[model samples]
Target: MTIAIAPIDPVGRAFFAGVVSGIDLRKPPTAAEVAAVHDGMDEFGVLVFHDQDIDDEQQLAFSRALGPLETATGDIAAPHERRVSMDLNDISNLDKNNKVVARDDRRRLFGLGNQLWHSDSSFKPVPAKYSILSARTIPPTGGNTEFADMRAAYDALDEATRREVHDLVCVHSQIFSRGILGFTDFTEEERAKWAPVRQRLVRRHPRTGRLSLYLSSHAGGIEGWPVPEARAFLRDLTEHATQRRFVYAHVWRPHDLVMWDNRVTMHRARRYDHTAVRDMRRTTLTNEVSSLDQAP
Candidate 1:
């Protein structure tokens, strides 16, 4: 079956967002269709595929068409045992009772960190290249996920700022970010598990050859700057890049699959009611190496 691509927002501003339709997820895409999706990925950093109606098995089959999937790790609980594949990261707030956890629940508090803008797996040695999140259930209002076009954010940077950051590197760590949100009581083992990784401040898209700002909440500090100064700079850059003009907030529908190029975008989950159930599964595609420059 043929696939269709339509821009979700203005081409000049939100160039990296689009809607893809007319393809069956129950079966894998043809070679031409795969290429079309890749082209769409390179051109538009995020593609929304609606009404996919795919289960974890179908989702894995489709994700394999794009690249190798990242294996899930950690002590996270599995809510939808049968429907949610073991390989997929469960991003839901529901407990075994199929109800949202208490407001002070550890899982609920931990997830609050997602409200900060970040790319998937930025803290890992080998970060994720792309992330596909499928909506199994959603609330009636709020909980919209917002994405920033980092390429556009980079282009909007003044010449002096661009020159200053062109050769810089930022040390990123989940510990640093989570600590900022008062989740600092992590064990020594957890701290070691999330040790800092250095990443280039600017990323050049391997396919499109376009440059994008790779800012993230995981940013600990600039490589050679003082703690206060580095944090100030990082905060300023994040504020600049996440301006409203560079963002698109997606209101999800059940069965919607939203795939995003983590290399060129930052996303954050908006706040929703603490008592409402919200279930989502994410499959992350791993890069060949820890750094984008060494990505396959």
Candidate 2:
């Protein structure tokens, strides 16, 4: 099948939303096809490939074509071999037995962090560039993922607000975000592994030269600013940027592979029944090694 990319109208507005079809994700894409995929991602920021039923091996093969993959942090009870996959992260709510977790399970509570709008691994020193999530199992309703185009959001800001953030530096931490939801009891080891990192409030896409507001729920505070003022500013910016006009909400189907550029987008999971099952596996590409170095 010839691969093709088509735009999607998100409730009458499309902001970097596209649907990719006709490619067999089980096989590695040709050079031309890979170039086309990059072009779509660079322009759309979010691309959905429907009905691609690829396993972990095939998914890793295609993900490697984009860049070096991020390994799992071994923060869960999965075995050593699973953690060492080096290109996969299990984002599921299922246990080893493939059963839904009890509502009180610690893992489920920790996973609640996904409900907050954030860029993948924004607290990391190198940070994530792009992330791909494949839907294996989903509930009958809800659990949709929504993305906000920070590039457009930045453009929508008033001149004074834009100027204020252009040169500011903000600190990001996984601890801060989780704490906000009363999940404040991270083990000392976890805390040690994820100390805060500072990043610019505004980012420039190295290839497109477009500016995007680099906001995330992980943001702790602005450097050298009063803590309360910093929090207020960050909250205001988040509310302003995530308004309906800048968002694209994706409704999932079986065998769907959804990819988003983490640099220019923020995404979060919508609510669903805790008794039902939702299984998603993800592979992330980091700026430490990116496709942009070789993009056409």
Candidate 3:
């Protein structure tokens, strides 16, 4: 059956659909809806599903329908499920159960940049292909997921800037990034585990071969450049890509599910009260690739 999709933002960067259209996400979607979602996702980076009751099995099935699930690495992925794909109900700095810790954890780490804007899995050797989030519960104030269009950003770049960044490889580091923020969750063991990884600065979509802004907050420095200079350049590039003109902010509702292409977009959550008990379930899909750890 066809789903009614409505564009949520001014630029129509997002489209809203109902998962409760009574089709079981556990099973495969008809060819038509799959085609439609693919089309919609290309036009509107973020696609929202309203009021779909799904369990882990169903969620997995739904996510895998898009592609193979992304295998999370790093210490945060130590959780029984996944760091990027699973949702935490609470994100307080003081809570031992908190997946990630920081003061105003929701604002600083969880929501601050969650709302800021960067592509998913852009930091990994093989970055994420798609991410689907199911919001089971939401806070009363300030919890939104915003997406900036990397493809749009790339298209908007001055021809010179595009040429300059195109072939450059940027280094991505969780250890260096959290350290920069003074967040000390990673042990020396963790640091050693994460050697640096470099990805092409301008990402080419695996399917469409479209170039997008591949840099993100986790991007530590450039592969061959001096650290400070690389950091400065990445910061400026992010600032340019996330301009108001290229973004679409999603105000989430309970049972809202959003899926986006990780290669062409960046997104993060907005701040909400930690005490408010917000929870969500997420699943990330990976671009088809073989598995093996690599050296820096």
Better of 1 and 3 by lDDT: 1
TM-scores, one per candidate? 0.93, 0.93, 0.81
- Report the lDDT tens digits of candidate 3 across residue range 1-296: 55555666544443322122434464667766667677667666667777776665677777666667765453243455333334222222233454334455433452333434556655566767678877766778877777778888888889999888877877776656565556656557767666566677776664466677776787888877998999899888988888877677778777677788776777767777756756666677776641122111
Clashing residue pairs in candidate 1, if any? Answer: none
Model 3 TM-score on a 0 to 1 scale? 0.81
Off by over 4 Å in 1: 11-14, 74-86, 292-296
Better of 2 and 3 by TM-score: 2
Q: Which stretches of candidate 2 lie over 4 Å from their true place?
A: 74-86, 289-296
Q: Write the per-residue lDDT of candidate 2 for residues 9-57, one digit (tens) a residue.
A: 8456555789998788899888877888888888899999999888888
lDDT of 2: 0.84
Error of 2 at 149 (Å): 0.5
Report residue 173 deviation for candidate 3 (angstroms). 1.4
Candidate 2 collision pairs: none
